[model samples]
Target: MKRIFILGAIFTLALNWSCGNKKTTEPPVVKPPVVSKPPEAFAGFLTVLTNDASRKIEIYDPTIENWNAAEAKKWSWAPTTALGFVTADINTFGGGTDFKLRKVPVWNNAEYAALTDNGFAAIIEYPSGKRKWSKRLSGNLHSAELLPNGNIAIAASDGGWVRLYASSQGPDQEYYAEYPLISAHAVLWDPKTNVLWVTGQHAITKAHIITALAVGGTDAVPELTEIDSWRTTIPSAWGHEVSAYYGNDNLLWVTSNGGEYVYNKTTKTFSPAPTAGLTFVKGIANQPSGQIVLTRPDYNKNPRPAMNCGLNDWSTSTVDFYSANGQLDGSRVVNGACFYKVKLLNSSYQ
Candidate 1:
């Protein structure tokens, strides 16, 4: 009876060992990688260049569902309203930063550089609408860009020149140098490459700022040197607007008389943007969240007769918004006010 019990115990131990050694067929589980959520649409304010008798730079909060000039005009800057300021038609809106004062420039405290079609350019403190500097530029002024060295660059379309001013010298300082660019309409300073990108009649040119060395080692003045240029693809091309595609630094959002395009820096090629085929896009910019904001004439709606909508009454009272996927999501309209160019108020050139 003892021998039989011992054999039974050995059999039980073998069975337990076999069960423990068995291999399972199930695969190992994997947790998916964490992805951050995209920012909400129209999260911040949009700075718009409104062309009316006032010729004002208006700020509209996109977060407001129903925004209008009367109710939503919380902040605005009219050159006509400022003391001893030239009442020029507000043309371009570009973001600027005073790195010494603010780490992150917001809509209220940031410095903005703007130009008028009638040869007026100025650097104004936003919200306060105080003019830090003002100059009456020559030719048909289209755009002004603030440089890293506290200088300002102007693109005069009719004169075909890109002018550089030594702004640190003082307000109303004359330009020290000018670069030849036919029908120059837009100027943008690239912080990454330390180059200025200018859009001309038929090409996009890249220029380097050449600062002269003074006798005492002080920087005398800066000049622009053309590095290279890419001829645009549009037939009878007339470059009107150019802005950095914040969604991709390698790409630029360019608008011409024919249509809109995304210029790929890597490939040096031009491709139609999602908003391509849209007409009269005076301004186009990408938000940090990858959405696009733009201004163009809505011909379907007639301009208000009381206001001067400018040249053929082309200016519209609407600012259009597009999703990252190139879909038209929404629009904000300000009655009685014609908006020409729309810019994201935040200082995010990326």
Candidate 2:
């Protein structure tokens, strides 16, 4: 009886201890849900200016899901009476298809400067396709730049002239002040320095804008005072185009038949660009993303050589993009298209 009682007591104690040590029934941990971020958006596009009979100015988006030159065009334009402006004369401007679309600056790419091998320079409004100011002048008109004072400067290669017009006089305004620049092919207005840089066949010239003279009145005559000029960096080279280096305010991009170069504004010296030694580069565009867009006549495919700085035949169907280090990154080609120049469709101009 004593053993039984002892055994019973021990079993009861063990049972009690086991019951006490039992882990309290606990619920499992529940973690909060995770949230993910949305994908980033692309922020770049390019403007392709063609010199074909189509005379197309197309906006190309490189960020398309499956990029196709045919489908990549976001918008396009060809001069027509529907644009509310007199169409370029076919006889004078080459088959009414030679509106060489140049700088599309101002109002967030809302305005464009166009010219013909003949005497035609005009600023056309984008989307609406209306003329803000235009003029027919003598000389082989090549490029145009809008001045901060609401005037326009046009470069003519044939007559070696950079003509300034008072845009306030309206589209048909004929009066202009001329500055001689031998074989001038391109003009760019520097808003920061308030000067005009003209690229010609043999030299790059810088001119000071006489604000007092550019009052834009009927009697006011604008003047471009020659501050200085530098000879072509490449020996016997023909300067073709001049554009603001959007990545560097101290530099400007200049292309020539000899090669592509970067002109330092502070030093007034031309240096070989990353794409130096490349010949026949007609147009250049520096992008904020460190890429370089350039156009060169594909003579192999086009089978037409340039005729005395005239680009009527200097074009190809392909526009090339280079990496920041100057490697050929990619190319966009539109079959049967003659791409002469390309500009970045952004508001950035360093």
Candidate 3:
């Protein structure tokens, strides 16, 4: 009986050892969850001029998403040696030699054909390889804007006229009218009210004139009524150098060779904004956050002078951000030849 009890005790010990070994063994390997990188932030598109041998129109997308350096995409039609402005549509339009107006077809997407010095009123399609329409103007077009109603608003410098052209029946129908001022250069259309705003130098003097066009008229006659007129408070200075109207604020911002001013349509008063850091401010764009972005001409110096520079040069270009309280929040130096215009792609993007 004693011998049998010993054997049974040994068997019980062996079973306990096997159970312990099984519990100590490793379990199946488990994997970790996959992590995804964040999506890149999209910086607003910028119009830059190429400094290389081509001197072409380059569109810079400052990949704000990934915080990467700006990537430049060039256009086939070069605006070299020309005074021009780049519209937000990635179209570079400017006055060529001898008032020959031209536009780059569209940046990126090679399917579209390029436009090189097409006539004064050539309408190049965005991202499409086709010229929608073109019309001959009475004089050299200094500036042009595409209206929301699919028409083109143009300001002539020599003739001092503002005209509107509508595409109808496969041809551009032109409606032209004379304004009070000759040498009108800048023009814009207010999408909210379909009002056309025209700016130019008074034919007889250095003073500037602003006119509002009568909309929905088959006749090209823009009502010559002056919305606002001003002479440079400073001697021998020009007023109404550049004008932009903000639809959100209903304010008209104008900058001249002398200074910058904002007109409150509600109050019918004009107030001056800070132009100390601005030299030859060419474009005024309003952002979604009630801020303004100003673009200016290029500087000529290396280690480009900061925004505080009093002179206008190729190296002096900057983007100034202004809040609703009329205070400058910050500024970034811009490297581009002849920074003629700055536009906000979307208010929300800012």
Candidate 3: TM-score?
0.57
Winner on TM-score between 1 and 2 is 2
| lDDT per residue (tens digit) for residues 1-350 in model 3 | 00011123222321221100012121111121122223332234342321212223334443432111444342324332232323422233332211111232232222221121212455554433245555544464545655443445566555556666554223355554445456465665554445666555555654554545556554333333444442322211233334444444466766544335665545545566533323234456554445556654333122344442332231123544555555555555444333334443331101
Question: Highest TM-score, which number?
Answer: 2
Candidate 2 C-alpha lDDT tens digits along 66-140: 234357777766455666556553224431112333334334544554444445556666556576776566776
lDDT by residue (tens digit), candidate 1, 246-310: 76788877765445677776676677777554534567877767777877554322232333344
CA shift of 288, model 1, Å: 2.5
Better of 2 and 3 by lDDT: 2
Per-candidate clashes come to 0, 1, 13
Worst 10 residues of 1 by lDDT: 95-104
lDDT of 2 at 96: 19
Which window of ten consecutive residues has the lowest lDDT sum in model 2? 15-24
Q: How does residue 213 of candidate 3 score in lDDT?
A: 59
RMSD to native for every prediction? Answer: 22.8, 27.5, 27.4
lDDT of 1 at 200: 66
Question: Judged by lDDT relative to the true structure, which candidate is superior, 1 or 3?
Answer: 1
